[model samples]
Each structure stands twice: as C-alpha cells, then as structure tokens.
Target: MTRNTLEQEYDIVVIGGGTAGPMAAIKAKERNRDLRVLLVDKANVKRSGAISMGMDGLNNA
Candidate 1:
C-alpha cells in the first residue's frame, strides 16, 4: 500500500465529501476569503454520497 502525508497549514479541515461537506467548505470560504480550507474524502465529491445520483432529492435526506 502507498502512504501519503499532508503537511500544509490549513485554517479548517472538513472531513467527508458528502452532501453537507461541500456546503460547509463554501460557507467557510465565504466567511473568510483568506482562510485555507481542505476537503478530504475517500471518493470523488461530485459522484459520491447521496448526491452521487444528483441533487434532485436532497430535501429528503
């Protein structure tokens, strides 16, 4: 297996690229444009979580 290490400084680190992860990241940036944000996930944010299919049924979740 391969190993990876992240040594950069970040103001915020959001785990889970799921339904709410993206929103949180966006809001953080909006609050402070100079903030360093990182979104980590095991899968692609676009095609992962409940949104994998689309944002059509987001209210249901």
Candidate 2:
C-alpha cells in the first residue's frame, strides 16, 4: 500500500498489476534478492482478479 516514487529504479516493473504482475515480481525478486520490483495498475488490483470476487471464483468464471 506504499506509494512508489517515479525516481526509483526497479529491476523489473510490471505495468498491469494483474495476476501475472505479482507472480512475475515475486519470481524476479526471488531470483535476485537485490532486484527491485514495481507493480503498477490503473485499478485496484485486489479487486480485479476472480479470487477477489469471492463468488463462483475466477477459474469457474
């Protein structure tokens, strides 16, 4: 929930902040501990995926 500054330089920057964005950032960080990852999205990613909907679930949808 921290606001990232534009001046920061991340080893990997994920623009969509969707399911893939988090996955990619985690893997990248794991592979390189020194790597800095930035995830950005236009909307609240917490509510964007199927898991967040809490209904039929994302896979079923």
Candidate 3:
C-alpha cells in the first residue's frame, strides 16, 4: 500500500458530506460567493448516509 499526499487550499472544508454537511457547504457558499468550499466524504454525496440510494427522504422545505 502507498500513501498519497494532497496539497490544496480552501476557504471552507466540510468533513462529512452526509445529512447536513453538504447543506452547510451550500450555505457557506451562498453567504460568500467568492469562497472555495470543499465537501469531503468516503461515500458519494448524491445518496449518502440516512437517505441511502436516493435523495427521497430529504426535507424539501
């Protein structure tokens, strides 16, 4: 096994990408249009965590 290193910079880095992680990233972007926000997670954000498979249970409000 090998280790890879990443060198980068971001104004905001959200660690989870689950339930509210993505939302927080969005909100941060909305508040500051110039910010560079990065949302990271082991799984795909499209259908990760409690939602599973799809974004069906997401609160629309």
- For each candidate in turn, the TM-score is 0.69, 0.60, 0.68
Worst lDDT 10-window in candidate 1: 52-61
lDDT of 1 by residue, 6-27 (tens): 7799999988666787678878
TM-score of 2: 0.60
Q: What digit string (tens of lDDT, one per residue) describes model 3 on residues 1-61?
A: 9999999999999887567876788788789999988877777545565544466344121
Q: After superposition, how far is residue 3 of candidate 2 from its true place, in Å?
A: 17
How high is the lDDT of residue 21 in model 2? 59
What C-alpha lDDT values do all the predictions have? Answer: 0.71, 0.61, 0.69
User: Between which residue pairs do clashes occur in model 3?
Assistant: none
Which is better, 2 or 3, measured by TM-score?
Answer: 3
Model 2, C-alpha of 7: deviation from truth (Å): 1.7
**lDDT leader:** 1
- Misplaced by over 4 Å in model 3 are 1-4, 56-61
**Model 2 stretches astray by more than 4 angstroms:** 1-6, 49-61
Quote the lDDT for 48 in model 3. 60
Show where candidate 1 strays beyond 4 Å.
Answer: 1-6, 55-61
